[model samples]
Target: MGYLRLLRQRPILVLWSSAALSVLGDRLYGLAIMWVVYEATGSAVWMGIAAVVESLPYILIGTFGRGLIARFSSFGALGWLDAGRAVVACAVPLLWSPGQGGITVLLVLVLLLGTLGVLFDPNLGGLVPDLVRPDRVREVTALLDLTNRIAVIAGPGCVGLILMVVSEVQLFAIDGVTFIVSAAAMWWLRAHTHRVARAAAPGAVTAPARRAEPVAAWPVLRRHPDVAVAVGLHGIGFFVAAVSAVGLPTLLAVRLGQGAAGYGLALSAVGAGALAGNLLIGNLRAGRWLTVYCSAWTVTGLALIGYSTAPTLPVVLGVGFAAGLAAPAAAVTLRTKLAGFVPAQRLRLITVDQTVIRTAGTVGMLTLPVAVDAAPATTFAGAGLLLIAAAATAAATGRRVTAAAIMSSREPAGSQTS
Candidate 1:
């Protein structure tokens, strides 16, 4: 069958569509967010805080929620979370009145929005294998990567234009409506019956027997050393991701004096770069060289940090694109590896792994603004340090992970018994 026929057979395309919808809102939210905060408080500090609130908390949330999701059906949990995100995304745009327009309100709204995000991501990832064929996981992930790239490029651009034309309320309302579409699409997904990839290992798990979910990240990861290392290495990419997403843009606009548009342009470059990366980079034939992926993002963060001092749009985009390229490749690699290491039953926890990867990025988001605001030009150097730390930690230990994978291919132990 053709690839299009494969997409017709599964929920992945639909789920991927849902992701694209949310990402459009996600980008719009980014544009709207910067505009509202920058225009409202007139402080880059507020912008910093808003970014932090949106991205930072996921680390602990995913780290802890990994347990909670393990208990419920990943699909059920995701559906409810998707519903909640839609409600919140809808409500946030309405949170404005002359008297109510305080930094406090924006901060509160961001907090609420961030809280919902914590639940949404992992559950979404958990749905993938349940949706697509095993052999095609990487291809599907790459496609999703491409979808996100488009969203990143389009979100801010559309929102930026909307801000020029309409009121914040209307832009926000549109964003909310997009969320409604995204959530509704997710609801249409057949959660219970999506096909799983790992159903055929020797003593492979049968559908009926492996229903009891494992609760903690450690338990599942402990047995799967390979995946655990992949998660850590993925965190390197995440660390760089945070830097590019939060640290560089703020530094460019505030310290470099390029303003919000500069920041947006720089990010769009990263998105464009990532789209290019997905197209150009593939083939898990040398998958064990996970360090190469870590190095890619580390270079991204470091280069971006250095680019912070440069006063050119093209320079910013160039650096951002390199980072972007590394980011998605890292993501594609880790997700593909996770599919190999995990069972059908542990999809949610695996999703949590993806979430936690970004959660690490969130940690960077939390600190980056303050660092940029306080030190101005030098904060990016701090980002470089963060990226390097993540890279070195992962690189030093990734071989152990590769070894485990080698062992798994020899004999898959986590295979479920029917």
Candidate 2:
């Protein structure tokens, strides 16, 4: 289904709008908070600490709090969480001061918001499947991905525009307002969904069976080896891609003698590429999703290597665009497959996948910056090679798993000794 038609459905429209606004708010808050921290402390070290703190919640929640996500996988709970985040975000400007004590409070608030985010994300993922037809899940996923890309491109620009007229501290208040609007929309959606469920004929729709015992994502992953391979490759890709967070700016400064304008252009290229890629994949009807997923990463790896070799700004932009183009295919493919799982298992696995990716990214961010600065081209090439190798491993493993399944199916009923 086309995005417009699908979005015309009130539930999908509300959900998409809420998500878009939330993401934009997140982007604005991230930039604003970082600016505030640096301005108040004038320390790069403190900024780095704040970055690490922001990522810690994802690892912590995804590891130990998966059950929390499962338990609160409802619109009402999600709405409240957004509302809570709003309060936390707005507190930053009001509570902060100019000394160490103020920075400590700011860090705590950042952690609180991040924790709420870690819970909010997987629950929202689980909720999406219930709102769309089975076959149209991929389309909805693409649409959501598109929202993220637009936010990536536009959010910082929006912040820049806002800063021209208002103080950086006020951005937090604006972000809080966005969250409040999102919460209101979600509450309305919850009421609408409940009404539709009640109005449906008794036997018209069957609900997913609830499991008495919560299933761990690892066991389910073992049962689906192909998904396991895709997820593993995804983690590696994330780890390698983290280089860009530091590497891109370094590259533009060292090699091209360009600063903020060059960096912004490169980022814009990436966002535009991702937007196009999502649209392309969403419209296609394809099989062998595992192959497509691996291929996307392979292309991404190639783009990274290309970035290393590029000696000009234009080349960097082109390579960044290519890398962005391939990203959504990998993400959307994995999400579409996960959506096919039983609802209970699906939520856990999504959480696990997110944890793995976040953990890998955090590690990469900590470890790769020095190498990127020392030898930017060599480091990019090395990371690209590792990414390609990871993609190859996933593809080969998927093929073996597929062959084994086919051979087992071909065996006679009596020949199968359980």
Candidate 3:
């Protein structure tokens, strides 16, 4: 069958579509939340507090949510989480009122949203390997990343036009509707999978049994030391990328003396570059992944440094585009490798991988002010150098892992699991 035919027949397309919808709704809902909170509290401090409330849970989940993720299969975890988020999104607009108490309610809803997100994001990624054939994993991942980037680009671009047509409440109500679509898609995928599994095992009294003694997240990390090191380096890369995402606009607006237009241009350049990079990466073979990841990170760091030292807006924009281009190589390679390394049987690692990188990114974002206070250029240089080092470490350890695998068998790393 053609790739397009395979895509249409798989639940992965449903998963991909739902993720895009969720992202769009999330972007719009975030804008609505900020506006409502600011209008109610009239204090930037309260807004800051709201932001913290929203972010803290993800960090907590990254550290602790792995065991919880292991309790249910990835699909079960994902479908239920989507359903819960849909409920909260719908309730936000329905239950909201304009008062101090309304601000309190918003805070609660944001916390719930974050909590659901903590479980949903990782588990959803974890589910991909199980749902699709091993050969298609990389392709599915690339497609999913492509969908997410499209949503990220469209979400922010459309927010202004969307807000012009509807009140904050009305916008959130629409956001709720998207969540409902996402939830429904997930449930449908679940039912379809169950049916397929049943058909595959005709006359069997029951479906395949769940793992009787599921291992914990830390042990899985311990077992795969190379993956652990790679994951750590990946987390650092994430941190640098997250910090840059916030820092670039400030550099453009405050330090470079360019206004909103420059910041917007730089941001769009990053997204566009990332989209292009994903397309480029899809063509590369699996054996070349380690090289691609290392080179991408190393160059991305250099690009970030270039952006920091650039004298003109155009130069900054170009450098930002370069950084974006390199960013996804690490993401695609590491994610595809990790999915293969830790199969559906050892599901704990999915949550562990997602949570670690997410928490690290959040920390990087939160540390921005400190970096800025010390020196903006110095911060960029530090982050860039860290990424270069991470790439080197990943390459070194990845070799050891590959060598070990080769000694053990003729099978390639991709064939060892899943």
Clashing pairs in 2: none
Which portions of model 2 miss their true places by more than 4 Å?
Answer: 202-213, 405-418
Residues 1-418, candidate 3, lDDT per residue (tens digit)?
Answer: 2236446965867877776787788788878887888888797667667777887777786666556655555465566777787788878887899898888888899899888877677667767777777887777777777776676567777888887888886677778778778878877877787788789888766655363234566656555666777777777877887557667766666568988888888878888888888877755574666777788889988986887788898898889788778767768877887778655433556566666776777676667657765677778878888888888878898778767755656755666564
Q: What TM-score does candidate 3 get on C-alpha atoms?
A: 0.87
Worst 10 residues of 2 by lDDT: 205-214
Model 1 misplaced regions, further than 4 Å:
1-10, 43-60, 71-77, 93-95, 100-110, 191-212, 240-243, 246-268, 282-286, 305-317, 343-345, 348-359, 370-382, 385-393, 400-418
Better of 1 and 2 by lDDT: 2
lDDT for 96 (candidate 2): 81
Q: Which ten residues in a row have the lowest lDDT in candidate 1?
A: 190-199
For every candidate in turn, the CA RMSD to the true structure comes to 6.5, 2.7, 4.8
Index of the highest-TM-score prediction: 2
Please list the C-alpha lDDT of all candidates, in the order they appear.
Answer: 0.64, 0.85, 0.74
TM-score of each: 0.76, 0.94, 0.87
TM-score quality measure for candidate 1: 0.76
